[model samples]
Target: MPNGGSRPIFILSEDTERERGRDAQRSNIQAAKAIGNAVSSTLGPKGMDKMLVDSMGDVVITNDGVTILDEMDVDHPAAKMIIEVAETQEDEVGDGTTTAVIMAAELLEEAEELLERGIHPTVIASGFSKAASKSEEFLEAMAEEISIDDEEMLTRVATTSMTGKRVEANVDVLADLAFRAVKQVAEESDGYSIDLDNVKVETREGGSVNDSSLIDGMLVDEDRDHPGMPRRVEDAKIALLNVAMEIKETETDSEISVTSPDALQKFKDYEEGELREMVDKVKEAGANVVLSQKDIDDIAQHFLAKKDIFAISSMSSSDIEKLARATGGTVVTSLDDISSGDLGKAGLVEERKISGEEMTFIENCENPKAVSVLIRGGTEHIVEEAERSLIDAMSVVSRSIESGKTVAGGGASEIELAMKVADFSDSVSGKEALAVRAFADAIESIPRILAENAGMDPIDTIVELRSKHEGNGKTWGIDAYSGEVTDMLDGGIIEPLPIKTQAVSSASEAAVMVLRIDDVIAAKGEEGGEGPPAGGPGGAPGGMPGGMSGGM
Candidate 1:
């Protein structure tokens, strides 16, 4: 065992695909359970908060499941897939992040049991699909009788996403605001297209301003320091990008040498003249406003001010379109690109001097274009949470409003879908029938997620109860850790339950799919955390960096 002769240090053997498959399945199940449990309580308006703390002891209080998963410091690749499901929902609906995550976890849990009992993952997956379709039909049938105008619809929608919690109050306010904002923007247009950002949902320490007045056009930004930024325009034109282009950088190894005093003086004169000439050329081109990448120099600023020309600096290229729309003006990066038609006729801003600053209202135009939202917040923390919620709310509401309708809230939509799928699966032959159970398992994930979030043991409870109920021939049911199959309708816990089910189903399905992947794709610069220490795996890191980074 020393140097010359090598005895077996440890009879090492490469794992066969079969062996690795087992491990992979286990890992997938564990990861799925983790995700399901994590977002369970985030369901319903009354849903509880998940106090996520990082190594630094920073804590986050939130009932939003997708947010919790996205912010959680998860290591497993499979778990990351669950995160992706939440991300997908956030991207698609701006809401349903929680529902997606919880459903995923539940799917995985059920899959794990089914797999252990000799059912193929593919079978479970198929079954789950069937169940999903069947569930959808059920929900639709249930919902058809429910009037959209009924206040219960609002409560049901709210409660479905969030349990009956204090947060429902906040969600209600935001939902109302979202609805109003969408309506206002749509009313201004013939088509469904609306400038979502224009609906400013500001939470001010003061109060809301509710004055309703019509402008011939729109105002993009609330304020522009210059007096000539124009409030309205006719026949507006625009462009928008996500970059600034004011600051100029010198090329590498480029040099300008002036040895003598006369030469230096000539160089200075030439530079100043060129700068002045450039400004003159832009003005000659009929440009009234020049939105720059950086703040203007004193000379340029003075020149524009004197010319009664407005030059807004430090503007992102994308916002230029909004400015152009709001002012019925043209937006271009290079001043040379501007045209006569591009420059729409401008209007004046109504100004009122308040304190030392001026409050200006720019209005009146035909088909004006602009984009902006004035976000107001109170203290730092309150503002932070409000902003996060608002961004998500905006994303969800915008997409739904644009699409002309909202889905059943709290995941009832998905559950009903799953049930329909189950019926369809029964009509199919062979492997297709497997989809029925897979889909049902998928829909079941919602309730499992709720149980997990409520600090109930999802696996032990759901599994035991399912097993017992199965023996008793109750094929359609929900299992509780308390070993009960209580009627959901009688319990007054129906809508939100579906939300949790959806989350779990989505999470589990996605997780299982990811785990089945045997190949590891290498991505450059991916931050793979080190393995768990000798002690144990730790809690997730702090919530995602402040600001609207992760949401749609």
Candidate 2:
């Protein structure tokens, strides 16, 4: 309220923070471009790794774009949107996360130039939308259908995904494992479906990465529960029990008073009797091997060992589920429900010590629906990185089988798409045509970055690529290994079609969203009164015009 008798006058506080017009647009575009530049160097086979140290001083070293962006503590809204572009690309295609983010940044950078030429944001956004849809159409037309049974091509796709990672020495071996694993778990219905969960990857640090091998059945991280039990069971009839061997308590808390010595004796006798009955039920079901999700009582263990049965207790629920799928068994919830049909069959169930740790291997099922891959590396970090690489490989193979198509990699697909998009720009007219042309130029950044990362002159490499592509050599791409422009298809550089298609759609959408923002309003700080000055949360360093002043 103003002075006493005057009518209440409404007014905005002086501390209110807001930025409109060019100021807001510049701040957002700068933040997004900064994030893109941070990851542009890590784009290809010759790309270098990023070593990120968090607040806890923990270090993560990887060239994987998604990992780098995910680990960064980005604060700016526009920067966060760029991270979403990477995440979406990863979630949909499992590879090309970096490419998606880089593409979006370049698109926004180009849009900024159009903005300076007085083109409206809506005009630029609409042009980008058209370019994105056209690129997808070009990608589908350019893609080559491949049979899921084509193991050689699948291996190439997997290897291409892992080429820039830390596990370069064993990429072939790992790629083979990944291809086999995905194929082993793939199912064909109306279309192909792959449950990657069925393909488990377990890592151990001791032997070299070449030691990694795929198992036809599931692997349990546990060993035999009792030493007296058989170390190995042949022609194993396995029972999966969720019920505990020990006596279960009442649903509600109740007291069982034992005032005399005879009462205690009776209690012990009752528990022993119940355990014996449980063991008898399992044996009657002809289950020579037992895997229990709950603990096994000492008395129960002795009885099972005396019967010469192989038994392990406290198995994880996930392991138990995998065992059921791999061995064609049903998880019985109660001992009394044990039946022959509930037992799983395995050629052999054995306990082996690998790297000084005991693990149970259930092998040689008739037709396993689930499998495992044991990844062995020389060190812990290597094993971890190998697992990441294998996951990427597995995901790419799965996507390829699902989509049933692939495209030449090594920047070949991008260059082809760029040329097609550039040709498309000719059909459109006015300011929108310039925006479409900028989009075509943005797509070329992939090949440009690939050449730059390989230490070659980007200009000469792109020129050669453009010439080759323009001459109808659609598969010609920069060979990062030798820095020579050659046939990516003949060189065995390939990737799943979904990766490129997803990158185009996701990156363009994100770029248009950022371009559409023309105003920003920040609430005042609790202690500082005003939140941030007009341009953004902070002033640009050295007073550089249109610099990213916000902490992103």
State residue 372's C-alpha deviation in candidate 1, in Å: 2.3
lDDT of 1 by residue, 274-384 (tens): 556556655666655555544555555556555555555665444454455555565555545655556544454444332234433344444454322333333434444
Which stretches in model 1 have alpha-carbon errors above 4 Å?
1-23, 53-59, 129-173, 180-289, 333-340, 344-370, 405-407, 410-435, 441-552
Off by over 4 Å in 2: 1-16, 524-536, 539-552
Please list the C-alpha lDDT of all candidates, in the order they appear: 0.49, 0.89
lDDT of 2 at 281: 91
Model 1: lDDT equals: 0.49
Give the C-alpha miss distance for residue 532 in model 1, angstroms: 7.4
User: For candidate 2, lDDT tens digit of each residue in 1-552?
Assistant: 676988877565666566678877887888888888889989999999989889998888899999999998765667788899999998888999999999999999999999999999999999999999999999999988887889999999999999978999899999999998888888889988988889878888898999999888888888898999999999999999998998887999898899999999999999999999999999999999999999999999999999999999998898899899899999999888789999999999999999999998999887788999999999877888899899999999999889989999989999899989999999998889999999999999999999999999999998898899889899899899897999998998999999999999999999999898887766565654334533343445211224544323
Whole-model alpha-carbon lDDT for candidate 2: 0.89
